[model samples]
Target: RAGLRFITCHEAFASAYSDGTAVRVTTDPERTQAEFARCSAADCEGWRSLVAIYRRIAPHVLPFTNMPLPSGAAAFHALRMAAGLRGAMLDLRHVIFGSSGQLVDRFFRTDAAKGAVLPWGFHQDFGPAVKGGAAFAFVAALSAHMKGLVVAQGGADAIVSALRRLIEDGGGTIRTATQATEVLVEGGRAVGVRTSTGDVLSASRAVIANVTPPLLFGQLLPAHSVPDRVRKRAMAFRYGPGVFMVHLALSRPLAWKAGDDLHRFMYVHLNGKPDEIAGTYAQCTTGLLPSRPVIVVSQPTHADPSRAWAGCAAMRLQVRAVPAIIAGDAAGTIRGRGWADIKDAFADRIIGQLEEHAPGARDVILARHVMSPEDFERENSNLIGGDCVSGSHHLDQNYLRRPFPGWTRYRTPVERLFMIGASTWPGGGVNAASGYLVAQDLLGQASKKAPQRGIER
Candidate 1:
């Protein structure tokens, strides 16, 4: 195992959500229900029932989190899921196929209660109105309630540092600033890589590409080496809504109108009501900037103060459902044609909304950094058009059909060439399922060949 250290999060709250009024979702189920009860007694009961149902189906669904689907595990999960559906016929349909909005509607009556859980549905590129979003929403809320929020002590770079140590300690070399221009092939098999520096580094076993489909197909693997159908599908791979990021170095901590207790939670979502959120999704997908953006404000310093200077806070605002290309502004305030021309103006709108929740928040800002869709692409080519998730997680583009239909097992058309990353199955986030599954598979294949080669470990 790769050794990584994590800081203990706040004991009280997992996150806070607000439409106009705020609701703090506590780590304790009893306390969370109490918060829901403030909305309505029915919501409190609904929350309890939802939790019980999630516990039933989570065992069936969570296995696929760390493993690829369509395997024995997937088949077994399907059988269990089918059984669950039979037991909770009415509720399970909403859990699986209904939009997140509809799923919450079944349980919650007030906007505050619905707003708290609805934002989880937008964890990916999808909106709360999209079908299959309920699955994501349910899983995210359950995970938060069960495990609270976990953060690396020094930030994500700490995890990367640990991985770097692991790789180097295992006698692996990592070359920075080196671009892999081509995957060298020989006799219908991947052999190595040709880098931008005109150096060809040979691989003894396989070449794993942790990149997008477009970069993998015609760009890295030459057209002659790949089948036409595979190449076409890869070329046609769809990217979802672009994401925009704003980092604020606050001179003082944010003062939430809800209370000082709100500062304890790592995430605070400025999620309007369900219907408003649906409209925001509609605006962004159609290439228009939403009048009111759904914002997730992450306060890392709340969990780990080491991330910022003494007495200061480092806040990151994540805005999703943004257009890859700007066509117009729903507010009709900006006249810019592209993200570059309008990012600052758009960021201002985001900051204005933040000010409404936490007054004097803008006054405390010591410094600010904004990354538009174009900026994200420049930072990482895999984030095409600033689509932080790489590819859409829509049912058509996910699971068995991820990256494309013929290439779900991480194996490509060229033998010994493999693909893994956010673009592959079990898609996105920090879960390294694709990497682990591919490694296990390669090891299995190696074990089978070891007997023939007269090799011993």
Candidate 2:
């Protein structure tokens, strides 16, 4: 395997900025309490409420671990209990509600006078996931506080290299630049795959697809081979709002008005009032770019200097809740042109916003690469409109109900065909829970089928 290392940092550890003020969140409960105590009374109360809710849910959910549990009634009951509710019916909105019967945002408005809610939407992709039950978002925040953040020492490429080495060491061959055109099926069983170059690679055991449902059902598989109902579900699979990313190579590190703490934390969220965050999501859903969108500024060079050249920095600006296809601009400044035409102007607007928080952000940029939603789809069809999560995490499409009902265990109706990746349970993120679970299932089946070691049939 490739010799790679990882750098573990505190999870849920981020510095949130609004206007000129800032608040740093960390894993230590006492430290978090002490930090917020200096803020307004309302801010303190809001932070306490979020912590309280997390505490209540922690015992029941065990969000950090990937232990397998029963998928039916027992799972539902445990989830409901974790949210501190007593009933069969439960959703994300119910899970995050405070004692006042309102959402957690009602309690945790950082700038109460300015009406700024905590930017929970930063953890989610779609508008509904932001507007509705942010149960997963809340769990993610709490888990970060509990587990701390873990990153590869060299970078994410370190992970790819390690996996590549493992595959090669195991005598497995990886064909790069090869596109799978169709899944060759024989008698309702997946037998092999036909590549774009017309090479048929047969599968000995199973065909595991990491692509989206649409690509799997519509393009890769024979239309008549799949059931009508399953096909319909794939067609109706909802995708979340796409992402707009700006990668920059900076001549120097960012100079923020908030101080060096900004450089310490890995993620800096730039947002305004809670209402503005909500409005931005609403606008994106309607195919319009928000006048003021929430932006995530990350400086990897701070964590690992090797990422940048000497005396230089490597940074990324990720703007959330942007539309995949542009119909209008809320600021009414950038014309509603296609991504190719408007991406640069949009990047300029985003950079201007960054400059507002970090005064010297624009001056430090030596080179920049912009990846709009369109670019994401062009590069990887799985993105399907630049949705990094693959599919939406709405209530209907989450948990055991994910991908689609009746096929949640990674098995498909077609024999020897399985599915995994972000589209499966334990939904999105860098975690390989889906792949791990699928591997476990396949190993279990293989063990069951193997003949006794001493006495062969």
Which of the numbered candidates is closest to the native, going by highest TM-score?
A: 1
* Model 1: lDDT to the true structure: 0.84
Encode model 2's per-residue lDDT on 1-457: one tens digit a residue.
3798776565244544644666666677776666666566676776777667666556666542353333554577665665564432243336543211135445554453222224544456634234334565466555666665666767788899899999999999999899999998999999999999999999998899998888898889899889999988877788888889999999988878777666656666776445566678888989998788878777667667778888888888888678888889988999856999999999999899888888878888899999999999999999988998888877678766778887777777789888888887767788787778778778989999997788766
Off by over 4 Å in 1: 1-3, 8-20, 80-86, 89-93, 451-457
Worst 10 residues of 1 by lDDT: 11-20
Candidate lDDT (C-alpha), each: 0.84, 0.72
User: Which candidate ranks first by lDDT, i.e. highest?
Assistant: 1
Tens digit per residue, CA lDDT, model 1, 1-457 = 4678887564423333443357777578878888889889988888888888887767766777676666787777777777765777566667667778888898888877888788888878668768878878888876787678788987899999899999999999999989999999999999999999999999999999999999899699987999898899999999999999999999878998777777778888885568778988999989999998888888889789888999999999989779988999999998887898899999999999888888899899999999999999998889998999889987778878887887887888899998999999888888888999999999998898875655676
Return the number of clashes found in candidate 2: 7
| Model 1 per-residue lDDT at 453 | 59
